[model samples]
Target: MYTIHFETLGCKLNQIETESIARFCADAGFGVTMAHSTASQAETAPVLSIVNTCTVTAKAEQKARRIIRMLLAKFPFSAVLVTGCYAQVEKAQIEQIDSRIVVVPGTAKDTLADFPQFFMDLLTKAGAPKTAEEAAALAKDLRAWQPLRQIPAEQTENRLKPNSKDTKAIESINKFRLATDSFMHHSRGSIKIQDGCSNRCAYCRICIARGESVSLAPAEVLKRVRDIESGGQTEVVLTGVNLTLYRGTLQTESGERKMDFADLLEYLLENTDTISFRISSLYPERVDDALCRIIAHKRVRPHFHLSVQSGSNAILKAMHRPYTAETVVAAVENLRKAKDNPFIACDIIAGFPGETDKDFEQTQELCRKCRFTYIHAFPFSPRPGTEAYTMKNQIPQRIAGERVKWLSDFACKSKTEYAKSFEGKTLKAVVEKRETNIGKAVTENFLHIYIEENKQTLKDLAGKEVSVLIKQALDISGKDEETEATAVLVCDGA
Candidate 1:
């Protein structure tokens, strides 16, 4: 029986992927050491390791390599496996220096009832399962004994995947029930409602890798939420390749559509008091009046992550992003009309193919005009197999990197200025993470507030939504703004 350590880097999607990977390993009969259950939760040991990485930027790639080195140093004789977008596109470079690390581009596609068997197969190309007594005995023992171990206060499933037995990992989680996470780690968990994307935005390889979009039905989604509720989750987040694309019905042959995202939201609001739901990122073009109205529901978190790839109209057309900048502005305005000053997050890519000084200025102007609190600024990275990969006059790497820095810094400044408006004002918030009374929570306005230190009681606030005033903006590095007062909790978001 081999033990494994799971590490994931970047994005909510990456977090979901790591969970799926762990589930796969647990199901395959290999015992998942209860050590690092969540991506942020880490323990130093467990020689066998897997790094689910990200390569959205050069920095992310460097961090992936750093983690790989750190893991190798910790587990000298351990089998190491690397997977995710970074490995998928940069396989040659990844293997060149860390040949000792087994690289699998699309790990989710590979079935290893457990991580150990995958490792065993890495040792030998066959991922064949074991009905053999030695392996069976170990699997059986691990299963029987797992429940007795002191799992952390917050593990969704105390007993993880039943000994692999060649079953698909995460299928169970995706099926009847989801693991319950204890602690205040997102009481409303993100459920991957769909996987993969079809639109290949020139500078992205995600579409090519994840393939066409496929969505999970509402029934299945409801079942999973019910499971999470049974396990102690209070809310469920509807996440997807593109959340707006959940197209499924009760009966396929009848050609009758059961429900779309809007319908799903109405159903969840009506049927389950045990659940509060939030939809993940949505494309600006995907938002219709129906969807926007559903988002206006009081129960839904007033947060919309609109993808505004570029502000330049020419750049948008060249990048093949569906929405125009004007359309994006209109969507933002429409949401504001529905849910006043709702926390709108957006993605901005700088230095795309054919991007000129005028185009960059357009992006800057959009940033100034758009009222987004959370701005994810990224410089375009040309990925392999993408149309922009071969496109000439590619934004110089250094220039792209500079753009990323400038945009990100500017975003932080803008976000801080936006957040400053809420200082001392009462706003509903949910306690997300905590260390005593000193913890972090998100106001419905979608502001991240750090609970003031020294004098507070966090005892009643765990997973509870309380009223908070926007105190002061903590700089990206955690330094506090002088004019800002401390965050004080007043009571729930809904």
Candidate 2:
């Protein structure tokens, strides 16, 4: 089987989409591998490589470009397919990188499911291009084939129509069921229930790249959840660009009902048994009482991450965020009230245009008031076409870095304290890493705990939600990377 390697950069939504495409390829009889160190690999190089790009930060896009360049240089014979937010915004720049590259923007990511067939057809057509000239010609042809652009109506319609071959292909792809099934990349299953963001924040280009908000239908989401449960994946994360903005329709016994994110969660809880759900992230303004009530469900994991950009209303208003600092505090309060000691986290941009010293201090004060267990602090990087890009009084890079460091340190302290709270308590955890002697699992409240494997093979516990007794917490904070908030634990009854 031809090997296809995937590298994903960005959020859980991007990872879900990549896994979906990987499953499709695997179903099409292609060897799917997720790897980051392709340049150092000693095994046979893959015939094709797909890098799912992220445009969240300038650093993310830089890394994508670097990875793509490395992939092209190391595996000359492999053709590269780049897709996702970064590709959507900088298609021309990425396309100019190499002739072997094919750019598919984030908007057409759903079309990625049909890529395996495209790759198969390309291989069949090439039939072993032995010479450099033959390979170059093949690459040119591959680059010319824009999968999402300007397809003939008849061909598109015929492809969409139900047929024996089409049915078989769909079955094969869906056979994988859960996005993480037999996949080496992720331990927990992921379902992309929503995509694209409608909120046009001043500092964000994701809205431009992803376009308007769109959500998966409620029935389809429930079906995906059922599939994950049947596959023995006890923990599944519901991912999206803006999860709080999710809106869909569900056919109820009485009639068709419009459902929001909270309703969707409640529906899944009512329909499925034993499967725990995790919400990727939320907007502070949208965290209503209904959402908090649904979050109180036992099956729903007590971990929530919010996209709270800044704690200062001044900076927030400048960024065009709908919620105020007080809104975040209320949301956190509601969440805590709903679930005891829920692992509340938020994203914080330390420096934005026109942010005064008082504004920065307000952000720090908010973090202290909210007592977030985790804080994703980013030094604001101006992006082209963003309102903040041209906004005056841009914070200096040095000052921004310092603010980020302060938040990072605070986050480390908060996370370690939170982990300490769980010490000696037995909690349900989904196994994430299973080696020969040691296994790692994440608790419902998002603590990463490592346990010794005795009498049972660690591999057998992979993807299983097993009981673990937390022994102690460890602070593994770093400068470049966020602290993992890991702890050492013992398996229950071990």
Candidate 3:
């Protein structure tokens, strides 16, 4: 069996895909292990390392490159496989990094499941020994397979030509990959219901790297959810590239019917029991009254993230985003109406190509009006092929940096206020980490609560759902604080 260690960097979608790939490798008789750092462990070193990368920002790409180089240096004898959006757009550049590094685009990530077997077959054909150690040693000098290197940067579709698989091998893994029982990296379950993106926003390069949007069949989606529920997980986050764009077809006795993200949520809630559903993110324009009603269900977590790039109408138009500032406020209003004190978060790009002082004020005004729980604020990074890259009137880096700081400061204040709202109330949380006398868990509304053991001894609460009473909200400026506040819990045995 080949030993493999996987590293993921990006959105929840990337994380879910990494988990699926790990399961595939393990099921195919490969030894899957978690290698945290460069210092070698007493156990056997992994022979292969796979880095699932991101391309949302130039900083992310730089980080991927740095980490790949570090992994290569750490495991000198192991071969590295780089895949994801970074690999998709910068294939040639990544290929030039090292001969031992194999580059596979995000578009063909599903094919990676078949790669280990294909690799083993190749070694056998070359008269290498069949033992795991012997095969791993022989695999050290492996280079990129020629056929898989045929994907050009311009190709957006699933046009991979791997030498190992037949025409029947080229199917989306969304239809087959189910929720993993053993989560190697996370406490809760993550089910990737969608992949790829069809939208082409001016500042976005993800659509180019990911290609058109595709969703798992609704039946398969239900099966995946059930699989997670059977594993005793309390929560499952339904993730995707553009979650609001998910469109699945369901087979009913009265012929076939279409299901959007809202319909899927309603169906899953009706069919499944006990497990809670958390949506990764939603487009502001798609959060209508019908969707709000579905999210209002008790099974659906009262936390929503909106991909609202900009609040200024002109800046939004420049970014090619569909909705205006009013639409975002309306979405927030609708969500608040559906669920009391819902934790509403948003993504905001502070410095777009043509943002003026008035435009920036509009963004701040929107935040004030909506009173978001949190904000993922970042300065715009021009991607190579994006329309915003060549556009004039780019915001200066100094100005952009300042704007980011302003929005981020506001977000911190907002998050603290939101965390304080649930003080003294008992909420359901899944324990993420446990120490001797203390534990850390996240509440249903996504608030991080630190559990302090009382007279009872602390148990292994990691991955277990328990009731937590919020004692006090911590000061946001604390140095050593790991969670939003300190929580005292009353577990069954404790």
Candidate 4:
């Protein structure tokens, strides 16, 4: 039996795929360990290694390459399987390292056969082939590239929409990564609802890579949620490509009418006490009152994240985003007025092709006005095969970097203010873990609290909700002083 270890670097969708692979390997009788790498372990070295690599940016590609080279050395005797996005995009480059390294793309990542046995057999047939230098030039460019085989997301329309299918599934799975997965810890895992994108944003490669959107059936969804809750996961988060796009995979009561995302949210909220339900990022085009009203329920945490790539209307339109400044503002206004301790976050992309200083400034203004709790900022990088790759008016790296920094700083400032707003306000914050990495607790609104990890007053509070007086807001430096008013959690929600 082979000992195996896996490292996933990228989006949530990749993490789910990695988890499924882990489940697969374990079921195949492989011993699993959570160690950082496959090659070295206190008990024994793994005979196999898998690097679920990401290649969203040039930096990501470099990182993947570097990690692959390092791991390939660590497991000289082990078979290394390179898979995921980087594997899909940089197939030739990965194969150049060693024929021994089996590179599989995202499409093939799923539907893989008993890879361990297949790998063992391949290695046996190839023989040890001795010497790292000799093995380094190993090439497996013997077969022709597979013809483009497109699989439509759950529902198949007899029509084509670019690489819509793939993008949808990819986005569907990504919910696990970017969404609030930490809340569902130690119980049932969250289920991915849909996948792919057809928005064809000029600056995003997601549309090309993930494919078109499709959703799971209401029955399957209910079944999975029940299974997760029964198995002990107290919460479930619904995620996917334009999650609002989730309709259904199978026929249901409302005619062959599949259950939409809003329906599912209502069902979960009404039917189960599965601890909590978190609504991950839903594109602006999909946000609606039905969903909003359900979210306003006292049981539902006052939280929702928007998929806004650019705040400026011109930049947003250029990026092919579906919503505008007013839409995002309206959503925030609704949530703030309805829910308690709500945290609003968004995805902001800076330095797109043709983006002007004025355009970016408008985005800045939008961010300030919205007062988002957090913003994930990314500098535009051209992705081959995407619409944005060849667009004109590209921003320089330095300029893009600067914009990204400014946006990130702005979000952080907003987060600080958000936390301060809760000062003297009572909110339910569950004590998750007290890792030395950081002080730990997540508020109902999803603010990560790192207070004194002291054993009784603090450490003793793990998994318990206390009446926390938000006290003074922590600074960017994370230092605490007497001038800082301390937080006090009084009543236990339990």
Candidate 5:
């Protein structure tokens, strides 16, 4: 059987897409193998490899290029196909890097299901037949075939300049569909309920790459949730580019009902039983009373990741963020009041254009007041085509780095304090990792707990909710710390 290897980089949404592509390949009569598997390491490597890349930042784009180069070196003869944000935004740059690599933009990602047939057509033109023996032998000695050279000029031209039919096919994808039967991660499932973004944050390139926002219908989302629940998935995370912007209309028994993010959550909580749901992220202004009330449901995990790009109102205004510092604080306060010990996290850009020392101090003050569970802090890297890139008074790289370090230190302290607060408290956790004498689980509030238990018991507990008592919270906040010392509840009778 012909084998294919796959690799994914970036967010949970990208992971979901990669798994879907793998399933599509399998349905196309290709056996799947890990990119670094022993089979792939053999003298005859897998004939095909797919890399789903990320371009969230310049660093992310660099990583994608590095991975592509590494894969090329490993599988010299195999066909390499690259897709995702980086490929979408910088198609010419990626194509120039390697002539053999097939570049598919984000708009053409859904068309990945058609890639296997595309590959076969190329092979047939190169004198390879569809018979089992010939296919196997072709895979073994694929280096001699030079698939890239074999590709017809017309086919290459079509890929470079897709006609209106391809455009229409891409535009028609309104609902999120899973091409894979199983998720890459067994402990929890992720469903992309929405895609793209409408927000034009000054420093963001994601909106440019993802295009306008599009939400999946509530009925389709519920159907996917039910299917995941039936598959024994105890938890499902609803992911999207801008989750708060999700809007759709669903036909119910009552009649046609328009559903926003909150309504969708209520519908899922009311209809689904056996599966808990968690949202990927939200905007502070979108966290209305209705959404808070729905989130109070036990099935909705007590974790809220807000896109609070800056705690300083001045900086926020410069970044074109929709909410103010006061708005963000109020949102967190309301969420805390609605749910007990809910994990509140935020995305913070340390330094932006025209940010003064006073602005940085305001951010620190806000961080101290809010007591966030964690903060994803980074020095703002201006991207091409973004307003911030050309804005005046850009902070020096050294100053930005210093600001990031200060914010990171504050975040570590807040996280440590928050985790310590749960010491001796029993929380519901889902097992994610198992070992001979230890295991790791994540609580609904987004705490990572390490439990001391037998491997078999922990393995069996995987994908199931169990009560875990937080015995101790070790201070593992150092930069190089690999595992936090979180002692959890022991199994009864173990």
Candidate 6:
């Protein structure tokens, strides 16, 4: 059997997409293996290797290129296919790195459901390989073949032109079809409810790479949830480029009704009984009262992550983020009022063009006032096509690095304080993994809990939600300081 090795990088959304592609490949009769799996262990080289890349930061893109080079070196005979934001934005550059590499842009990546057939057709065109020996010979020849340069006529046309009116209708119908297989084997599964983003943040290349926002149909979402449940997944994470922008129209027996993100949550809560849900990051301004009320539900995890780039209104305006510092404060207040002690996380950009020391101080003040449980501090990295790249008053790299260190240190301290507040309290947690003497779980408010228990006890609790008393919050941040601090959870009867 032909095997395909897959490597994925970037956000949870990228993970979701990679899972779908894996499922598609499996359905097409390819044996799927993790990228780290050795070819010697598999006893044969994979026919194809896929890398789903990310380009959120310069470091991320560098990592992707490094992985591509490593994969090429290890799997010399395998056809390397690259897709994702990096491929979408830097196709020419990636192609130059390895002319044999097949770079598929994000816009056409979804059409990878048709990739298996495409590959088979390519092999057939190169002399119709009918026997096993012929197939192996064809595969060897593919090492030198330039598939990307000689894409089929129909496939090339489809990528170039817009879909016809009839094709759009058919695509809309197909969008609601659910995949029979689960995306991930873990208890927590993520379904991408929305794709793309409309927000034109001055420093972001994601909008240009992902295109406009489009919400998945509610019916398809519910169907996928049921499918996941059937596949033994207990928790689900609804992810999107901009999750709050999810909008779909529902048709009931009575009449047609519109459903926003809030409506979708309520619908899922009212419909699905066994599964719990966690929402991905949302914009601060979109966290409305209605959405907050729905989030207060017991089945919904009380973790709210906001894309609050900076605390200073001046910096926010420069970044082109719509919300103000006041708006962020109000949003946090609203969530806190709706649910007690909800875990609030914020993304902060330390250095931006035209940002001053006073502006950074404003950010610190806002973080202090908001009392965020976790903070993702990133130093600004200018992308080539973004407006911020050309803007004046850019902070020096050394100064930006210092600011990031300061913000990150504060974030760790704040997280420790937040974890300390839950000490000695009983919280419900879902066991993520079970080991011989310890089990890892996460609480509703997104606290990582490590339980001390025997192998069988931990196994029994795996993939199930159970109550645990928080004994002590540990600072497990020694070598991997970037990792979160985990709390020690004592099993009630163990």
Maximum-lDDT candidate:
3
Candidate lDDT values, in order: 0.62, 0.77, 0.78, 0.63, 0.73, 0.74
RMSD of candidate 6 to true structure, Å: 5.7
Using TM-score as the measure, the top candidate is 2
TM-score between candidate 6 and the true structure = 0.84
TM-score of 2: 0.89
Where does candidate 2 have its weakest 10-residue lDDT segment?
162-171
Task: Show the colliding residue pairs in model 3.
Answer: none
Across residues 1-494, which tens digit of lDDT does each residue of candidate 6 receive? 67778888898787777878888778877788754544234345667778999878898899898888877666665657888888876877887875447777655566676676666556446644344455345444553344443433322222211111111101111321223346433446888888777776778777656666788888878878888777776678998889888998887999888998999989988888778889889899988888888888888888889999899999999888988999999999999988889899989988898889999999999999998888888899887666776889999989888988888778778777888888888887777642422477777788876776665776777766777777777664333533233444454422
| Per-candidate count of clashing residue pairs (backbone under 3 Å) | 14, 0, 0, 29, 0, 0
Best-to-worst order by TM-score is 2, 3, 5, 6, 4, 1
lDDT, candidate 6, equals 0.74
lDDT score for candidate 5 against the true structure: 0.73
Better of 2 and 3 by lDDT: 3
Better of 2 and 6 by lDDT: 2
Report the alpha-carbon TM-score of model 3 versus the true structure: 0.88
Could you give candidate 1's per-residue lDDT for residues 334-408 as a string of tens digits? 788778677788898877877888888888787778767667887776655567767877777677777777777
- For model 2, residues 128-205, the per-residue Cα lDDT tens digits are 455435545666776566665543332211121211111111111121222444445677888878776777688887
What 10-residue stretch in candidate 5 is worst by lDDT? 160-169
List of clashing residue pairs for candidate 6: none
Superposition error at 73 for model 2 (Å): 1.4
Q: TM-score of each candidate?
A: 0.77, 0.89, 0.88, 0.79, 0.85, 0.84
After superposition, which runs of candidate 2 have C-alpha atoms over 4 Å from their true positions?
Answer: 128-135, 149-184, 433-438, 454-456, 479-494
Q: 1-494 in candidate 4: lDDT tens per residue?
A: 55666777777566666665676666666766543543353345465567887767777778777777767777565556677767765666787886557666554565443464444454456653355543433323112223112322331111223333234433222222222223212222556777665666765555445556656667767776776666544455666657877776446466665467777777767767745777777776666677777787776777688888877898888776778888888878777776765888888888888889998898888888888888888998777655677787789999999999898777767777777777777666666533332235566677666555454656555555555656667654233321222355666434
